[model samples]
Target chain A: MMDSLAAVLYLILFPGFVFLLVFGLFCEWVDRKVYARLQNRVGPPLFQPFADLIKLLGKEDIIPKNVDSILFQYTPLIAFAAVMTPIIFIPIWSATALFPLQGDLIIALYLLSIPALALFVIGWSSVSLYPLLGGFRAATMLFGYEVPFILACLSCGIIAGSWRISDITAYLEMYPASMLIVIPGFVIALLALEAKLERTPFDIPQAETEIVGGVLTEYSGKKLAVMRLMDDIRMVVGSSLIAAVFLGGFIVSYGSISWAGTDLTNVINFLLYIAKSLMIVFLLAVIRTLFARIRIDQMLDFSWKYLAMGGIFQLFIAVMYIGILHG
Target chain B: MDLLKWARMKSPWICHFNTGGCNACDIEVVAVLTPRFDVERFGVLLKGSPRHADVLVVTGPVTQQSEARLKRVYEQMAEPKFVLAVGVCTCSGGVFHGCYNARGGVDTVIPVDVYIGGCPPRPSEIIDGVVHVLNKIAGGGLAEKSSVNEGQAVQ
Candidate 1:
């Protein structure tokens, strides 16, 4: 009972809602700052994301009369909860997570899709023209990206010989040098993740110029704030997943600086995990800054033709490396 | 001030609405968002949805057809909304002041807090106008001032 209670507290407080929220907002700050710098503009202050959230929360909540009241009100919260669940399964500062289970990687992948699904529902339930169109676009984009993303993740699982994320990290730690061979698959997966996050070059679903905020056109106040936070949390999840799968999750010390205490090493590992996640976010921001939004058809075509092919090719190479070369 | 109020003042997302004037003021407003002026330094983002915006930046003179649209957009915005009427046209219809279809300024449709006067105000002036709206928000005068013109639409 005590252990269960502790787990619940941990889920709600430390590595779950509060921690992910703060970390996600920080990552958002880094993203915006880097984007601004790249464009030769001064960005908002470090507290900008936090301020935006607070302001949104303080605004009056408006529910359009024509909308389905129940779904419209609850979808953002559900989406947020869905995104927060995976953080508990991801090993941030240790080899094992708060709730590590065999074959959790598949579950994590499934959980990541819920937010996009929720977005589609939000768009459809709003009973508005722009949002309905946005919803259809979002669903189409989801299909376009999910295949390549799954294939890329499948490659990582094949290389590590385990469907569990902790096992994958353990395998990587056992043979640290194998990361070089995994880089190609990781790059393919990273690009897919960028599309999944709906950044520039693949932001057709939320194309502001074309659809007036797209699926988020009708959302306001607390709901909008929740949705924005969900996006940031998705960023955290994507970058952390990349860090764990490619960058050797939380194994910061390779005998360079030997700390006398395990506690100190743990602290260092935690900080290193944060740094690795931030680095991935910085890379994503650079991609966002350099590229313009692509047309919906163009995005779909690129995802289906180029990314899918690249993912398969990388997966084949990983299979060869792990099956024959490494063996 | 309270943290919520401080946050509201710090991050004011503006939604630009072109009621119906020449494209000059709209261009100037967009310029303010570019690297040169960068209104984002003050956490002022050009939001695509009025639902997510704190300040409604209305450019162009209010046309007969857009008067209802302007009112609807203002109504669509969540509470504590401020309107910044950019350019003389948006302030009082400028060159199109007495034209057949002109409906005067944005003030004719929705209450405006700040008026930026120019044929097309420079990006600097637009930024200044936004800062002034921030000042109004910080002073706690937004509510009382907006209430004065509540439900009073121009004929």
Candidate 2:
């Protein structure tokens, strides 16, 4: 009974909803701060994302008469729920996930894609000209990024000889030297993840200047808050997933010194996870800061021509490395 | 309530709309977003859509053609929205006053909360206007007046 109770608390609190929300906002703050500093401007405070969300929640939610009311109302909630599930599969404070499965890697990847799909759905349902265009653009951009992202992730799984994320991390821990083989895949994954995030350079789907808010043009108040939070949470999930699959997961040692009824190793591993994820966020911010928004065709061409090829190259390298290792 | 108020004050994403005038005021408004007078520190993002905006920054005089569009834009913004009429043109038509196409200030079409009086207000002045709105938001009095936005246009 106590075990079940602890599990419930674990799922709802730590390494779960609350943690994801706070950490996601923190990552957003770091991204904004870095982006602002790069432009030689003062950035927002740590509480900016939270404040924006809260403020948005307090404002009026206007559902346009022209919109497909049902889909428009439910899309943000659907996207938020979709983005939330993937983080649970990620190994956070430990080397293993809370509920490790044989093919959780693929499951998590597919779950992440749902948010983008949700965006497309909402855009179409908005029935406005900009949103229709935005929806089409989002669907088009997904094809450009998703293939390379999936291939890059699969290459890491290939090296580990397992489809499980924890197993891949375990493999990396076992052969720390083999980290070199995954570097190309990791870079490709990072770039593809950036595209998936719909940030600058790949933000053609919601290019503010060109198409207003694009997919998010008609969203306002509580729904808009939820969507913004969804994006922020998606960033956290994507970065942590990358950190786990590529950066040897969290380095948790067996020495469990219980301090104040909590394992010291858990705390150490949590901080390590945070640090690694923040590093990814920082890199993303730099990319966001340096690049201008690229045209949709350019993004598509670049992703297929360069990122996909790079992912294929990484897959080849991983296969060769594994063959040498067993021989 | 305090937290809600604080959030509302801190994060005021503005959407800029030009009713009709020369593009000088628009240029100055854009300058406020640049590094020289960054308003982002206060969580002010210059949004593109009125739907995503908490504050509407109106530039230029209300021209005959833009009056309907201006009203539509203002109505599109979610509630708890504030409008800052930037430049003398937006405040009271400036040099464009009595022109056949110009219909006077933004308030002639839609209710305006704050008025920045300059032919083309400097970025510093624009930032000052935003700060004034933020301060009013802090007091919790301005939001209540949004619905009754008549003869309440504070200069």
Candidate 3:
């Protein structure tokens, strides 16, 4: 009974729904602040995203006529669930996650893709011309990013010789020098993750100037709020996923310090996760600030020509490095 | 104040619309979003979609061509929305006051919550108008919807 209670707490509290929610908003604040500073402007306060969410919650929910009411009402919830489920597998404050299943890396990546699919459904079901166009663009862009992102991530698992994220992290921790071998994979993963998150340069599906918010043009009030939250949490998940695979996920081990019956190492590990994840967020913000939005054709061409080739090359390097280390 | 009201005041996603006046006010409106002015510090984002907007920042004189479009955009906004009329053109139609194509002001079509009047209001003046609306929202002063077609006809 006690074990079950603790399990439920872990799933609902720390490193779970509440924590990810707050952390996701915090990461967004950091992104906005950094993006603002890059442009020599002051950004919104730390509480800005929180305030926006609250305001959105209180606003009227508008569903357009001639749309599938059921799908329109539920797509945001579906995306939110898909984004949140991966948090269980992410090693947050420890080397192992709350639920560590074998081959969980693939599962997490697959789950992450659901939000994009949900977005496509949102655009298509809206039945409006712009949303339909946005939906097609979203699906097109997903094809551009998903292959390279998955390959880049799998290359790290290949190097660590484990399909589980925690094991790959532990392998990197055990052999810190092996970090050098994953640099190409790290760079590839970072860029592909940026595309997956739909930041600038890859934000064609929802480019405000071109498509008036693209897939989100019709969403308003609470539904839009949920969609925004999903995006924010996806940012947190994407960045941390990259951080874990390439940057040695949550370097602190369990029980490193047991002081007066209190294990503070978990706290330390949580802090480390914050630092690494924020670092990834910072890089993402810089990329977002530096690049202009590219056309869809250009995005696809870049993804196919450069990003995919980079992922393949990185995978080859990881394989060759592992062979050298063992053989 | 409650959290919802506080959030509404803090983040006002604005959508800009140009009626049929000269482009000077529009230039100043765009300038307010630039690095020098940077209204984003107050969490005022210039959103493209009316559905995503909490504030409609209307500029230029309301011409016959744009009055209907303006009303449509205003109606599309989610509830608890505010309209901010900037420039003399939006407030009184300015030089286009008696012109055939001009409809006098934004208030002739949809209700306006705030009006910042200048030949072409400075960016600072535009910012002030936004802050005025934010203060009104925080103070629980709901925007008054004026009756449409109240502007005097051009003779």
What is the C-alpha lDDT profile of model 3 across B34-118, one tens digit per residue?
A: 9999888999999989999999999998888887888899888999899999999898778888888887788888888899999
Give per-residue CA lDDT, model 2, range A238-293, as digits (tens): 99899989997347644565778876887788888899999999999999998999
Off by over 4 Å in 3: A258-262, B143-145, B149-151
The true-versus-predicted C-alpha distance at residue A210 of model 2, in Å, is 0.8
Q: How well does candidate 3 score on lDDT at residue A239?
A: 85
Evaluate model 1: give its lDDT. 0.86
iRMSD in angstroms, per model: 0.6, 0.7, 0.7
Worst 10 residues of 2 chain B by lDDT: B146-155
Residue pairs with backbone overlap in model 1: none
- Identify the leading candidate in terms of DockQ: 3
Give the best candidate by TM-score.
Answer: 3
lDDT of 3 at B8: 90
For every prediction, compared with the true complex, DockQ reads 0.88, 0.86, 0.90
